[model samples]
Target chain A: MGSRIEERFSETKAAGRAALVTFVTAGDPNMEDSLALIKALPEAGADLIEIGMPFTDPMADGPAIQASSLRALEAGQNMIKTLAMVKNFREGDSHTPIILMGYYNPIYIYGSQRFLDDAKAVGVDGLIIVDLPPEEDQELCVPALAMEMNFIRLATPTTNEARLEKVLTNTSGFVYYVSITGITGTAKPDPDAVSRRVALIKAKTDLPIAVGFGVKTPEQAKAIADSGADGVVVGSALISVMQGHMKRDGKAASTMVPAVTDLVRSLAGAIVN
Target chain B: MTKSDLNTFRAGPDEQGRFGIFGGRFVAETLMPLILELEQAYEAAKEDPAFEAELENLQTHYTGRPSPLYFAERLTEHFGGSKIYFKRDELNHTGSHKINNCLGQILLAMRMGKTRIIAETGAGQHGVAVATVAARFGLPCVVYMGATDIERQKPNVFRMKLLGAEIVPVTSGTGTLKDAMNEALRDWVAHVEDTFYIIGTVAGPHPYPAMVRDFQSVIGIETREQMMAAEGRLPDTLVACIGGGSNAMGLFHPFLDDKDIEIIGVEAGGKGVETGEHAASLTGGEPGVLHGNRTYLLQDEDGQIIDAHSISAGLDYPGIGPEHSWLHETGRVSYVSATDSEALAAFQLCTRLEGIIPALEPSHALSHVGKIAPTHGPDHLIVMNMCGRGDKDVFAVAAHLGTDIEG
Candidate 1:
């Protein structure tokens, strides 16, 4: 189980340049489009796909991200629907590792161990619970490890050396280095600042580091890759792209895979070594 | 219970400030420095007699202290079991117990010289309360709310807006109370030095739970004096529905010394506890940390918090206030549940029977009142904290039960 996550990390690293990680709110806009966007991610040059499990209160999100979530909820997104979306993704592909990212409520309501087993059964390789910290990791991290699911920890810029050591202790998957200390979709951090944090984290662990929170453009991705991080996790940027191309014609909204795929292709362009 | 034995009640946290199996500052590092600063500042303020005097002055002058202990003569007859009395917090300046804490926080913020106040709301009651206090203090205010809540709780949102508060509609996640809280936290982080996060409940990190409860203690203090004046005795049972639980704590604290007075907290059981749709923390939770303190929470095996669903927005949280957690563990209070259907039935019953429309949150307690009053015998008196009125809930209730407002 440990080796599997490590291997995924190794594969991303072997590519030498950083891997583009794309995040889409599950059941956002609509479930059908959300699933299509998931399928198109790999072809769009995304090595990792982060699917947001829509929560009632994503405190870490900005207005745009919040609006995207409302649209998803309006379209009727719930735990059952989110799990179904993952199951559908598994039916078509198995190579591109899927990570379920969000706050803890949906997973809590779904039953933690039950959610973990279900994620594993349906091929969800990793989880980035925005709110869960190392001091309280015993609740989910241990159980996730037992189920062979990777519990990724988000190490923020405010994390001190002592706190970072504690946060990284036996943490699985990759160290999710939040580029900034603020919430999601607010603003991008200086690539130099993110690289400094990345260099600091690399000195402590053998685990691959993925930078997230405000890494929107290709330039931002290239900059983070230049800083020695393993991957870039882009959530709100792609969510905005999907919202932009969504037919204003008020007609049947097709799945937004094509536009998101184009955006992913552009993101990959930033990673050309 | 002993004034001299304060150490007995004092549960020391670790080097990191954790209580005995509870009470730690579990916040993001962005807020950690602020939280730590708050800890030190709170310690300093707690020792200041001037701060205490100011809080007392505000309680008496601003909030209309000594909120009534109204005896429900008809309700006692309707139950035909125990005498029923209500702590009329619904009559408070903002029409709820939220102002008790809000006044204190606003004062503290003023003393700290913070320029702005930020708060989060689910049902919008807390937001309204904060807005009112901010208005009184002449401080700029902002409130974050989930989009779903803003629509359902439109009247309160409008009320806040009218009070000159800047409303930020959070469209994130399920766009409920939790999302509102998260957004408020982000806002606090961005503007920590100049802003005060006035948590509405007796939850959150150190000082907040303690501070809010101290401010709300007036409820218990007044209830004690009022009960003594009217009945020359403390009632046998005290009831209040728990949200962030400041209201319940206020009513329950005065009776803590009277061990014979049964303390009960009613939790919102949305559909039913069996269906994963309630906020009945004390009845179904283990000790876990959320918002800022260690308490009873609705979490999965992974310890991630779940979004609680209750017919009453105030009670729809995956966690309970921390003081309730202490009370539950210490066996000082009893915790119970009332489902959405049950609470609604109680809400209608109260309005029809007593010409009073109880908030859905309190209806949960009222529903439990029916169950417990009969078992305690007709002589036993049960005094409940009627935390707020049902005006905010009429639209939601009408839509949910398919009952017309005109009817």
Candidate 2:
């Protein structure tokens, strides 16, 4: 079977527009609501879905995603529950690529081989482990590739030419270009600078390039898409939208799914237009 | 057991910054370039004679090193077994072994032309040490301290402020050492251009564990010479507390090749390990990644980090140095735990007998000494690293013991 990530990018290319990659923490607030949100995402214009396996210490994340993970954990989210949520989402949706993103410890503890088999069985198409750099390929990257799953690599403003080659060696599915040098949702990226870097990376790899980290609003998504990125990824902003609609006790405020889906819809519209 | 034959133990952390499978640069892509540059700069600085001379000069004159190694006669008598010696690192300028690392790192930051310094503190000893050096160098310093630490370690917090360092109170996680470290890492990523992160322990990425160990090894280096001078032979055992395991690493690295010497690292068993309220990473946790390296960490079944609890603020950390993990696996060091009550009793015993009020960190080690010292014969000499002074911990200790202190 072909990779869903490759198929989705190809479909977007035929449509002459960048894919809208939407990210949400699995089991955030609660598992049932999070599964409902995932089921509603594709219909709401998300071309690709990224589910965060909520971790206790998300050092690379900003306040928004960090709090989201904490809420998920407090609501009794674990690896089993997170994978079950993905399996539940796969029941209605079979086409939209689902990418699990987070640190490596959870997977390492869950047993890498078991995690790979379970993820593949549950229709997880790719992974974006933030802490596993290219230097740590032996730990997860090589094994994930062996399972025919895309081990997505992140390239940053600081990833020089020499380092970029190492990053691209085992990376599959797509390359995530973090436009800023800081954590998520903290700063804005310059569209012109991102365009130059995207062109530079495109010159090196044939894979799709998705720009994220600070691409929040519809306007920012359009600016990044116009800069030659194959996909536009938004995470913290979507999480913030859900957080804004959350009640005082951290339960979803009835419109939480709609608030997230509405933002994804706007971002998708901007990328396609 | 000679220094020439010590190559096997000394030549660790190969070119990849790993002590076996423990240490590596497990960080995001955004910080990769900065860590690589730091590695290069550290390599050059390690070889430069000028850097050596400068660090030596500061160690001797500024920080007052070659700290005296004193024999605890009364304590040894009370135990009625092994003779005990104290490696007096607490007598240093900042009242701890933390200054040893801060001075070396600050010099490197100066050589690299970094304008700002950022650090993470657990018990606030490292914060004061970093703030002290930053003040001396006339550089702006930002210290991320957990709010829980700020409340318990108020004296050290005030010292950092008096030294003109800005304290960023972290309320994340359990509001302690682990949370403070997370905030510092986030700050380092944002200010990578002009900022230099002085990690206070033998943890973090490659150069940090190796580099900080190199700086703090003065404790072991001096202890070896002092023990030989005092007894005309090497001590049979070594003991020190392990939080991030800096002071213990400092005291253990030089003697790693000496196969006859027994090394013990004491961890804080808050209430007890069985109660699940402890900072005994090697004793209670499994190997995992946090801060920057893969080491033994207190984490849940799902790999989410668990908050560590300890009466001593400095020992309340969830992870240990990667080198310690490698050493524990290699059977070079035996890791054990001392309960909060045990350490408190040891603290009072040492103050009454030795007239030296030891910090709660080393009191954990002292508690272990109380156990093993009585089991050994008189010919066995034990060297314990008195890593910090206890003045900063007076308020916390009083509160824990329920002593009503009159103003």
Candidate 3:
């Protein structure tokens, strides 16, 4: 069977619009609320879901996603619990593609083959390991592909024509095009510049290009969608909203889920329109 | 390990920068071109005699190279077994061996036409070293340090500021060396064009571990010559404290081919490994990735990088150099750890017996000497790298010893 990532992009293509990819740390606030939030994402208009695997040192992330990971880890989130959340989400919504995104250390420690097997068993369609570049593809990317999992690769502003060949060699599913040179949530990408890069990347690969990092609001999502991206991803802004709704005691306030879903709805609506 | 593998140990990193599946360019794509550019620049610099001459000139006239390999008469007498020698790198101009690598990297930064320098520091020795070089070369420098480190290593913090370097205090992920490094990498990613990152240790990406080790191998090079001149032979054992394993790798890389000499790397056992509060990556951690290199890292079962604990800020890092990991796996180097109390006692012992105030980083190595020295015969010679001076560590050590000093 082909990946749900491919299936989702095909559906979005049929709808003549970009997919809305929503990101959330798997156990942010707590596991129960996190599961509830993810289950609500698809109906609220998220075409694809990216679940963050919380790590202590998220070097590529900005402050907001970093805080989200810490919150998840502080609430006792681990690979087991993260997968369990995916399993739970898959039970109700098998059509929505769920991508696990984070660093590679946890999966390296968890055993790559075992992680791929368990992740596939729990219906995790793709992975976006932030720290694993194409040079170190043998570590996990090759094994992940052998397991028929979509090993998504990231394309950035610094990825030259020669290097792009290496990056796309074993990559399947969608290509994540980082809009800015800095870490997540640091700076906004100019739509004209991002559009040029997205067009260049589309010329090189058949995989759908998803633009992320620094796209914060509905307008930003609309701009990225207009830039020829197949999907528009918003992470730090959503996490920031949830953070704002958190109580002083660190528990999620009653508005946490609604606040997050409302933002996702707005972003999705922007792209759909 | 086989003889072929042992013979090939010196030839590693192999184009893509893997120390047998350890070090690689595991950075974001935005940093890939910069890393590759750095790799090319470093390779070219390695072959250029003028680059070597300039670096040597800086080492000799500026950083005070060939730091003496002095025999510790009292400590050796007290140990009653091996004759202990101190590779007095603490006598270097910046008060640590960190300057050795900084001088080399700064020259490269200039050669590459980069106008700004960035670095990360734990105990602040590396920060001070980078800051000093930045000042000397008239380049703008920024040092990323944990807020806790800035508070604890006030002297070095003041020194960096005095050198006219900007200090960015990082308050993320337990606010230590690893966090500081993350922040620095983020800064490098943001300012890749005009900035050159002088990584403090033999960690991070590929060219860094190899390049930093190349720069630091001067320690081993000097030690080899001095030991041969003094005793007409190599030392039986070599010991060095490891945070990111730069100093240890500096002293170990040159001697890796010598099958007869034993190498030991001491890691910080903050309270003790049993207490789950230590920076002993090889001793207590599993193989994982952090910063950039895949090495022995202190991480939870689910792969979250765990905060490392140590009384010494320099050794309080959760990951080690990938070369150290490869050496450990190959059984070329034996790794051990020493507790905070043990290191404190060793610090006091070295100060009293040797009349030298040793940094807490090297005190971990000295602690191991106390244990291993008694077992070996007097004919055995042990050289331990005194990587830093204790001046910057006085306040921390004083507080640890429960002594109050009013400034």
Q: Provide interface RMSD per model, one decimal.
A: 4.3, 0.9, 1.0
RMSD of candidate 1 to the truth, in angstroms, is: 5.8
Model 2 segments beyond 4 Å from truth?
Answer: B1-7
Could you tell me the lDDT of residue B300 within candidate 1? 60
Sort by lDDT, best first: what order? 2, 3, 1
lDDT of 2 by residue, B1-407 (tens): 23343456778798889988899989887787888899999999999999999999999999999999999999999999999999999999999999999999999999999999999998999999999999999999999999989998888999999999999999987788888998999988888899999999999988899999999999999999999999999999999999999999999999998988999999999999999999999999999988789999999999989999999999999999999998888888899999999999999999999999999999999999999999999999999999999999888889888897745
- Chain B TM-score, one value per candidate, order as shown: 0.93, 0.98, 0.98
Ranking of predictions according to TM-score: 2, 3, 1
Q: Over the stretch A1-273, how does candidate 2's per-residue lDDT look in tens digits? A: 569999999999999999999999998988888888889999999999999999888888899899889999999999999999888888988899999999988998899899999999998999999989988888889999998999999999888888899999999999999999788887999999999999999999999999998889999999999999999999999998888887877678889888889888899889889
Error at B34, model 3, angstroms? 1.5
**Measured against the native two-chain assembly using Cα atoms, what DockQ does each of the candidate structures obtain, in the order listed?**
0.20, 0.78, 0.79
Candidates 1 and 3: which is better by TM-score? 3
Each candidate structure's TM-score, on Cα atoms with residue i matched to residue i, is 0.76, 0.98, 0.98
